[model samples]
Target: MYTVSQDCTFTKLRSDSTLRVLFSGSLRLKCKNACCQRWYFTFNGAECTGPLPIESIIYLDQGSPELNSTINIHRTSSVEGLCEGVKSGLVDVAVWVGTCADYPRGDASTGWNSVSRIIIEELPK
Candidate 1:
């Protein structure tokens, strides 16, 4: 099960300005069958075109307690287009935690819980 702890929405920003995106979340693995799990923060929608700026991949062990992780990205990197879209009001900023099983293949079981919080802030250029 996945839960959103905090969702932050920002007004349209200036396209030429720099910004910072922060993704923080906690995950707990409850499945004994799951050998390993990986988590990361994705930008925009899950299906957005172009390359998505993802945070560093976090690996977790099965039956592990709640683990907290955070990823920080700037607007000038590979996610410039996304930043521009947010600035132009054509897109909104959102953060989500995505996880996948690493050990068993073709396993459709769901025995994990996660909570995520996203924050977007504009920085002076």
Candidate 2:
């Protein structure tokens, strides 16, 4: 699921400027065994593309039935990243998951017990 932050809006003092994007917060995530959960950022309806994008990949290995182990339905955790070279303008910042369904996707939960946040800082260079 993509968590779109409509509240994130900023005016760039210049045209075609760069921005430092960071998406950090807590979330409960779970998926099939050997499946990797990828966390990425999107700005103005476009995925952040570059040599350095705001994305986090966490490889999780859990659940053993034959060993009498219980499967983790969802693990609660947080993510953090700092991506540069993102074009700045009248845009919307969003957080999205990629390629989860292709790898036996499960689900992600958040904004229930805590208030997550995103920050978009304009650098003065």
Evaluated with lDDT, which candidate comes out highest?
2
Candidates in order have lDDT scores of: 0.39, 0.57
Model 2 residue 103 lDDT?
Answer: 60
Which candidate leads in TM-score? 2
Q: Estimate, for each residue in 98-118, the C-alpha lDDT of model 2 and write its tens digit.
A: 545456444554444556677
Off by over 4 Å in 1: 1-6, 35-43, 46-52, 61-86, 101-117
In candidate 1, position 9 carries an lDDT of 55
The per-residue C-alpha lDDT of model 1 at residue 18 equals 46
Tens digits of lDDT, candidate 1, 1-125:
23232345565457665446665544333343333333333334542233454443333344323543322211111112233233434434554334454453211212124434465666545
Off by over 4 Å in 2: 1-7, 67-88, 100-102
Cα-based TM-score, every candidate: 0.46, 0.69
TM-score, structure 1 vs. true: 0.46
